[model samples]
Target: MRFATYELDGSVHAGVVSDDGLHTLPSGTTVLDLVRAGLPAALTAGSAALTGPPTPLDLARLLPPLTPPTIRDFVAFEEHVEGVVASVSGGSGVPAEWYEAPTFYFTNPYALIGAHDDVPVPPGSRLLDFELEVAAVVGRDGSSLTPAQASDAIFGYTVFNDWSARDLQRREMKVGLGPAKGKDSATTLGPWLVTADELAPFHDEDGFLALDMRVSVNGVEVGHDLLSNMGWPFAELVSYASRGTWVRAGDVLGSGTCGNGGCLAELWGRRGEQDPPALRPGDVVEMTVEGIGTIRNRVVPGIELPPVRAARSRTRAR
Candidate 1:
């Protein structure tokens, strides 16, 4: 079932999407509640237990599926890594360490926005970009999990747009530490969450989901690729994420950007161009994955802040 959280009459509600409308779940039940309970149980309980009338899907304003407790985004697609590396560093190949395991970095959970929300250009950024990806939401808490266990722990999937500020990211990484402020501006997740069972038919024997992924800018198609092309699967991403640490319910694991023009950086990288058009105010970005649905967001001007100054070194020759 496709589960959603939406605002109606100035109040937020969580429900199951259906042909007729969105069937409201029990009062006070958030998507996180259902994730914690497990989708199978929620399905078994069914909408028959709902206390109110269904709300028309179009009438409600959608919100992020849930506020993730933690957001770990991984670069599981080698093609994307190859292209981005070439664009950023003039490198033509991925690092060997990338092949040894699925690597991820934590993004700010507080920076999330809804499917159709306006994405403000991050302050001091000129090269704004959007990344086309999918994210898996954890259903239960687990640490040191195997791949199979990680698969079982996934409750659902959602369309994820990892908005980026390329120019800022470039400067910060020179310090060898971050994509921090560059990436912390905003992230988009929604339309709704598709339970894992609903996507089972798309899974291959090797565990990769053969879903079609696409992205568009201002109604013009920009990129397309298959989710199955990833070097590592979502289960492996989650499993690696769980090594020596807990992945709790509501923690989101991203599939990273797909190849073949998944983002503007990749496009620039492939063309060996340093300056291509980047996302600007009023540009709309829409990302879609078969079975999981779509998320569309519009870019807007950001509030500029005073520039940060370098800190004085205190431990020189002491």
Candidate 2:
């Protein structure tokens, strides 16, 4: 089932997507609310709601899939990792050791924007980029789950735009705390989330359920990829990620930046340090993942926010 959060007449409502329309979930309920209600039952109900809603998707502009409790993104794609390592170290291949486990970081869940929202052009980021990815919604809170059990613990999947400020990330990651400030500004998500069962058949190869990924700026195609090409599968990411920690319901685990070229860094060859294209005001970027759907964000440049370096340090020191 596809579930979403939306505002009509200035009120936020949750509901299921149906051929007929969107059936309002409830005034006080959210996707998280259903998670707390019991994942199994929630799954069943979400399934029923998909094609039964009385409201139309056209009447509702999409909202981010969930108001997650916490959002964590993991480096689960080997292709992206290899590309990054090669680009960073000037090597052609990844060390065998790099693929041993998953590397993840937390993002502010409160900062997420919805589909069709305008992404603010953060100050000082001459280089802005997009990462097309799939994020898993956690369900059935638990700790140290083995890979075998990770499947049932998942709630669903959604398309994610891990909006980035490439220049800042490069500078701050050198300190070892981030990709934080560079990453924290904004992360766009939504339309709605597709429950696991609804997307399970996609697990097969040939990607009969193929999700075509596309990105455009001012309606120009820039980055594109396919879901089946991912070096690491969704199940592997979740299982590897949950090995030693607790991931609760409403938690969104990102699939990391898709293949290197799928984001601005590689798209414009930012690593080679020549000159990568930087977006200007009125530049709109749209990301669409097959099956899941599309998210369009317009970029309106903001007066530079001063790189946020010392401010972050002062905040850290306090």
Query: Who wins the lDDT comparison?
Result: 1
lDDT of 1 by residue, 119-167 (tens): 9999899899999999999999999999999999999999999999988
Q: Who wins the TM-score comparison?
A: 1
Q: Pairing residues by index, what is the TM-score of model 1?
A: 0.96
**How would you encode candidate 2's per-residue C-alpha lDDT over 17-50 as one tens digit per residue?**
7667777864577888886666677766666666
Worst 10 residues of 2 by lDDT: 305-314
Q: Candidate 1, which ten residues in sequence have the lowest lDDT sum?
A: 44-53
Task: Give candidate 1's error at residue 253 in angstroms.
Answer: 0.1
Off by over 4 Å in 2: 47-53, 85-96, 205-210, 270-276, 303-318
Per-candidate Cα lDDT values, in order, are 0.89, 0.73
In candidate 1, position 57 carries an lDDT of 76
Clash totals, every prediction: 0, 8
Give candidate 1's root-mean-square deviation (CA, Å): 1.6
